[model samples]
Target: MPLKQFISGVAEFSANEVLQLDSEYQTYLQPLSGKSLALTLLPIEQTIQLQFTDSRIDILLPNNRADDVGSEIGSEVDSDCHLTIQLSALSQLRDTNQLTTLIKQDKLDIKGDLSVAQHLSALVNGLDLDLTEILTNKIGDVPAHSIMGTASAVVNYVKYVKQHFDITLGEALIEEKQLVASPLALANFSDEVTDTRYWCDRLAARLAILEKKQLAGDK
Candidate 1:
């Protein structure tokens, strides 16, 4: 299937899953009733709008032209708030209550109603779905436990490898290749420049004073 279709399917499935808990956790979403929010994923330029009711949410892909995946956020959005985020940061959003932290880390950007965004974050963090229990019911308990264990291990391993790779690449650029300056080196160089400028200004002032004294003597 096409990328857009796949994204739409995922969004729909996610919305349905969220709504399944609405009956029990509708209080979290009550503040967002009759409101809408737009989330735009960067680099892919896909925008998904979430229309919230008291107990349901409808996810939609607005201005989904595949050819314009590089275009800006669609102007057709009528959401109470809009959130723009990097695609890579979606995983970090699992900690939905840390909206301020994510913004500080340059992982998310928000516009429009901040209260709506906060309420949305509260709703996401409030979800208490027992995925392990669901899996145990669908399959056997042993299989469910094994699958969850394997999934968790794989995720941890991937995170470790990614961290290692980033550190290695940064070291190569800063130390091995000398393409990027080390922080200490940069700071020292900045201090040297500042000192040179200060001395130059002082020397200029002294020369002016000397010239004035020489003129006074000649008079």
Candidate 2:
């Protein structure tokens, strides 16, 4: 739950920072101001809600801060977008912007409208936030930028390593250990099933024709 807590805190902070920015920046998030998004993380079995208000984005963790906002766990409140994904794959989705590709690869599953996710992406990308200026009062501009850069690099490297590790482990299991079927094997099996069904359907149709002709001859 520490990661969930950190994510919530970051959302809150980002919302506050966006509010303090100029009106032009607010326009980027206007489309999402009244919508809600839910992210269901795999393995952890947690759903985090991002409730968008006109002022800020409230990140609600079930049985946690959600109670503060009068939200219930598994509530009837509909989300504009609900994404079910691996917790580890979140950064890849963000950094790569390959939502459709990920879905095709079975790396992500989405419910509800995709336009909502697009709007959310727009909100993130359109905001050219300069955090250095915000922190310059407390620390010098050079130090602020340096810290932000180092943090960004560290995050990217960690994500890169995690992604590669998952891929390597999957390969080892499928190719080396024979513990799992590869994607190509799955596709081939699907094709074989389809072909078998086609032949069965054709045979059934021919049998029906023969039965009808025999009845006609008997009559």
RMSD of each: 6.3, 9.2
lDDT of 1 by residue, 67-179 (tens): 76565566667788988898998887657667678899987998899888778888877777777777887798999999999999999999999999999999999999999
Cα-lDDT of candidate 1: 0.83
For model 1, name the residue pairs that clash: none
Return the lDDT, model 2, position 65.
52
- TM-score to native of every candidate shown: 0.58, 0.51
| Model 2 collision count | 0
Q: Supply the TM-score for candidate 2.
A: 0.51
- Among these predicted structures, which one has the highest TM-score? 1
Model 2 stretches with alpha carbons more than 4 Å out:
1-11, 18-23, 63-77, 95-97, 131-219
lDDT of each: 0.83, 0.79
Tell me the tens digit of each residue's lDDT in model 2 across 1-219: 588689789878977776666446667667888888988777675788788876677888755354457654345436888888877778876754677787887778988877777877877777765666766666888898899899899999999999999999999999999899999999999999999999999999999999999999999
